[model samples]
Target: MTQRSTADRAVGGLGPWLPIVLGMLTIFGPISVDIYLPSLPALRDDLAVTPALAQLTLTACLVGLALGQLLVGPLSDRFGRRRPLLVGLGVYVVAAVLCSVSISIEMLIVARVVQGVAGATGMVIAQASGRDRLDGPRLTRYYANIAVVVGSAALVGPLLGGQLAAFMDWRGIFLVLAGIGTAIWLACLTGFSESLPHDRRRAGESSILHDMRSLARDRAFVTPVLVIGLLNGAVIGYVSGASFLLQGAYGLTPQQYSYVIAAGAVTFVLGGIVAGQVGARRSPRALLPVGIGLAIAGATATLVIGVLDVGLAALIAAILAVTSGTALTVPSATTIALARRPDIAGSAAAVVGVTRYALGAAAAPLVGLGGGLSAVPLAIVMLVCTLGALGAWLAIPRAGEGASGD
Candidate 1:
């Protein structure tokens, strides 16, 4: 079979609406996590679970997300994007329904794990589909657009969930998610087309292992994947602990906390917009340092303020800074890593997704290890993660070369 450039694939009859549809599909993970955050306290009380176990529900979902991508990415490469994506969405609808009616904490956690695994299909396949059809600077722009969609969802999902929690209940959030999953499934059935041609599909199970090993051997791929994971972990650490910090420590109501979260999310959107414009002009190497520097500064400051027990305004500002940096870093890092091996885009996207969510899952429970009374542990974890990301970026051999499309 002949190889094709992303430019060639762009002209290979992909519809214009595909990006928007994929963007919608890609947010399944975020929606699953963010939409029910305001209900965490209520969930604990209603289910009679401990605080640590309450956070486990989130951790379980993250674990499922990480593992699901690890499994599905290669499957899509062997099979096709549409089939795996549809199957995942079907599972997501069922899991969401189960979550809505969960009778105990254990049941809810299990349901969330299944829900996250199913949700992973959307995140991985959306990115793989983009890779299947675009490359080079076009690929970078596509990821930037995805960042924007995710940032928007980050802003909207919590606010909507907070409102729903005030009026309805925690179960109501799951019901709404089920409805959303069903809608996405229907959309996929009608509007989506297979991006990977049959000629391009990988041959066998060994091919999956081979592709994974090849990616592991490439420094260009591994470094950016690590950086993305660390940066994502930092942000997720803040998210996992934010509810307790804002509600329990700062004494804010769910509605009020949602506004604070929304403000930080606005900065995330701004960062994505800025990264898109900068990426168009500069390479990933130039953008990565700027982002990492901002993250380190923000996380360090958060650590200091949290230790001092300063006001909520300082905390929010620091969180905003970290999130803004991530908005810039994640898209550029993902584009650079995936661009390294366009032939195995599905597998590549999967590796990146798995690393990101795995690190995030590890970070979430750490925030509550100190019992979530203060934001200090959260700040410390975020700072450590940012520093780790910085180290990974610096370790990249001739990082600028990796950023280039050649």
Candidate 2:
């Protein structure tokens, strides 16, 4: 018989295909949101809905992704990771199918919400799993690797979405999403063992309130979560405004805009890898301030360039710095927060997920204010967010710079 070695047998270390599968799960929300963006006009026309009504589909997904983490995280704590994740994947598949078959905008919108919730399940569980099994440098490294994987997903989702739209209608994209969910569900059945054993399980909803209070009281936990969330707010603002900044002002085509964003994402991926390596040698905290400094400089440049209407090259360089800097900060902050409360990893990861999405949604609209004809507003949003993140980082406890940030 073959040796039955896998993620289950590996403790305190990620096994083969572990990060890959988790990366795939982590991309669920991104794929759901980005893969169908090109088909919005077609979907709107087919469902006979106004542009604003059609846009609600996107809003529904973001809201669901944010709030659903609140539900999934605690459940995983109560019942172990395996069953909840499997159930979530099943629901996601069903929701995607429902989305694909919807005849009205309302139906599609509801289905998309369900899809987002299901996506959140995988996302939170992946982070919880990392915290459950790993610690120290390994913990931070896994998260950095996840950042790289997610960057690749973000870069590819739009390109794939644009291509899929050329060949078929919007429904086909949902089918593809369903297909992706199904494959991941199958992988889960085989690859995952209960990381949070029954003995460690807490009462799901009953104790969640207590857990939240405890997490809120800890400065080490709260500060890092703020850093992660605020940096993500800056990122979402950059993403929301980039198209307008590039396509509207510079007159770049959609394809060209994508290419420019893809370049930034490549830098993001490289930054994550470099951060992970440095974190392995030092602690995640060792490089945290460096990341913040880069982000501040980049955001400052972006704000100035937007006001001055500097050359496209300078603007792209500034944006890329922001992208790479954010990448460096995220995994470290995630590790610090998660490493603080391994016992309630699910709840902790849940809070982080919720903050990121909620703040991201709040920041997104700022990019479009005043007709969004200029990049000044988006640059301002980014600058404020990065500065906020820096302030939060400074508030973190100063005693754990050499350790796992516990």
Candidate 3:
């Protein structure tokens, strides 16, 4: 008989239903964020807010996600991943319902912030759980599973939101999401098991500042973290600005925009799957350059198309290319960041999580910097971010030390 590895047992023990449970929990944040996207126009009219103001709802959600992960990342390190997940889900359910009943854009923004905060708990906890149990390619596979489901939800969410907005009301989308959150939370209660054992936890310090200092000292850890953030920042730039680009520039309807966004989003999952395969064969360092190269090429193409007025097909192609490149890099980079430092997996994950969304938040405003949709401005922003990521990866010393615990 072949000797079973810890990773093999962990993967095998996941069983049929467990992936579904894990997938649902991990996807909640994206679902909550993207679902409202189709309703942006409708919400603007209903709540009597400007398009810029309506966009703030999304900004608030992104900020909340950053803050929530910031706190939960360390908390999960202290208490195992499960309890924080449970409490976070409970908060998410409440926030979702509150969003459904929100009377104004201000109320909606506040609720979205709450939902983001709560939803973030799910993402960070799920990440911590995976790090606790697996490493290298095995961990890559676990994250790939998450990327597929959550990304699929993001792909489908806008379409669903548009249809629901057309038939029922924009508020109905949140109501449905709340119900889904409740169901997912209930399922997690029975199906999930704690991965971080008591013996594995550290005894002294364990403070947020301490974790930050430790992560800062590690060159290998920080390089990948910056890459993850920049790559995600590019994606978020597209997401926040896509509506204007598709509807205004390309003359597409909400339904059409949904399809276009979904197409790009699906490739994100495909990239994640490909990254998992590549990770199994090589170190993340070997793969990072390839992924960033794709990103630079795609962003360059998008800029040319935007500047030359190359029409919708070219625009869509550019979007898909950049998104796919981003998908490939994100998980591999994240796995690298957490691969060392298993003891502070939560802290590592938290730092990475914050960097990811904080950069995303920054990208949102930068994507809008031209004061209108134009090719050169968006392209420049993306290139700046992607190049910065590439530079950071190169700057970090690759040969230094042994891998730390995740």
- TM-score per candidate: 0.88, 0.94, 0.89
Q: lDDT, candidate 3, residue 81? A: 75
RMSD of each: 3.4, 3.9, 3.4
What lDDT is obtained when candidate 3 is compared to the true structure? 0.79
Q: Give the alpha carbon lDDT tens digit for every residue of 1-406 in model 3.
A: 1222443354454556766777777877778777777788888899888999988998788788889988888888888777888899999999989988998888889999999999988888788777776776777777766767777888777777667778767788889889988998998888777766666665556678878888887777888899989988888888878777678766789778778877877897798788778777777666678888888888989888878888778777877877888888787778878876787888888898899878887887787776555756677778888888889878656665553333
**Quick one: ranking by TM-score, best first?**
2, 3, 1
Error of 1 at 205 (Å): 5.0
Over 4 Å off, model 3: 1-16, 41-53, 103-107, 202-204, 307-311, 401-406
Global lDDT of each model?
0.85, 0.86, 0.79
* Residues 160-235 of candidate 2: C-alpha lDDT, one tens digit per residue: 9999999989999999999999999998887766777665678645588888888888888999999988988988
**Of 1 and 3, which scores higher on TM-score?**
3
Error of 2 at 211 (Å): 1.2
Ranking by lDDT: 2, 1, 3
> Judged by lDDT, which candidate is best?
2
lDDT assessment of candidate 1: 0.85
